[model samples]
Target: MAGLTVAALGVVGFLGYQAAATAPDHPTQARPGSHASQSKEKDKDRGRQKKKSTALPAASGTGERVVYALDDKRVWLVGADGKATRTFEVGPSPASPDPGTYAVTSRNEGGVGSDGVQVEHVVVFHSEGGVVFGFSAAVDGSMPDPNARKRTGAVRESRADGSALWEFAEVGTKVVVIP
Candidate 1:
């Protein structure tokens, strides 16, 4: 009976270790230089490598362009080499723009949005159904909750991402929308 109990204890410990090893990505508590810690580091590197090797969908468009995925709620700034230079998440309004190619028709450094918030990095692309669609970030680094009853087509992004978009996109810059 004693021998059987010891064997069960060893099996339980090994199973617990195995479960931790195969767990999802999260901060690990392994001691430094331990095999567990080393494996965790390797796993993180693998994740980053995977992201680097994965290319944006071909329908995102060719050459330099801003690719917006409506379904994914993400945006990619594609460089001339047809690779994404910057990718970030965006919070699009309920009335999201249709999936189609567009051009940045105008821009404003700062302006008052329909939601009564002071916004910056205003890049207007299209207007439809009495709604003027554009991307903007509140000057105070806040997101806008536009009035649903009124015309609101603002696509809100993080302050840092909004700055990058403002600098890269200019008048006539191509904006591709993917479903």
Candidate 2:
């Protein structure tokens, strides 16, 4: 029994050392629901309680598709009637796509983002110049820092929003990026 216990301790110690050595120098904190509520409160306190407009950018083509505005950091799921069915704010990827129209090229149900966060509902649209732009949601419902630079090219959204986008955008669905 004593020898077995010693062997287990040795294995545990080695594993701990390996984990410590592999840890990142800087770890990110997940943005929680409370933080969002606080942000809303701050916006109200500053008298900026105006509702987010659902209007699509004028130059974005009228179609049944997803429209993303780089300047606004917002997305609109437009219906066949050329009206926005849903709109939500999102975090920009390390690299954004140039203003243009693209089609949903591929999709992965879930995966680890290059930044090491587990995300779901990945909807990819454009890939070129060493950057692939897509949409995903953190599995924990946490958000990465918008101001901090991320390693991957993913427009992070809330889980609910991500699911909506994943459902609305299928292979060959139109995607428009507007500056």
Q: For every model shown, what is its TM-score relative to the native structure?
A: 0.67, 0.68
The parts of candidate 2 lying over 4 Å away from their true place are: 1-53, 147-151
Best by TM-score: 2
Segments of candidate 1 deviating more than 4 angstroms: 1-55
Candidate 2, residue 172: how far the Cα is off, in Å: 0.5
lDDT of prediction 2 = 0.84
Per-residue error for 118 in candidate 1, Å, reads: 1.0
| Winning model by lDDT | 2
Q: Per-residue lDDT of 1-179 in model 2, one digit per residue for the tens?
A: 99999999999999998887657753335365677567756868655422533567778897798999887788999999999889998988667788999999999999997667899999999888767789999998876665556556788999999999998999999999998
Cand. 1 TM to true fold: 0.67
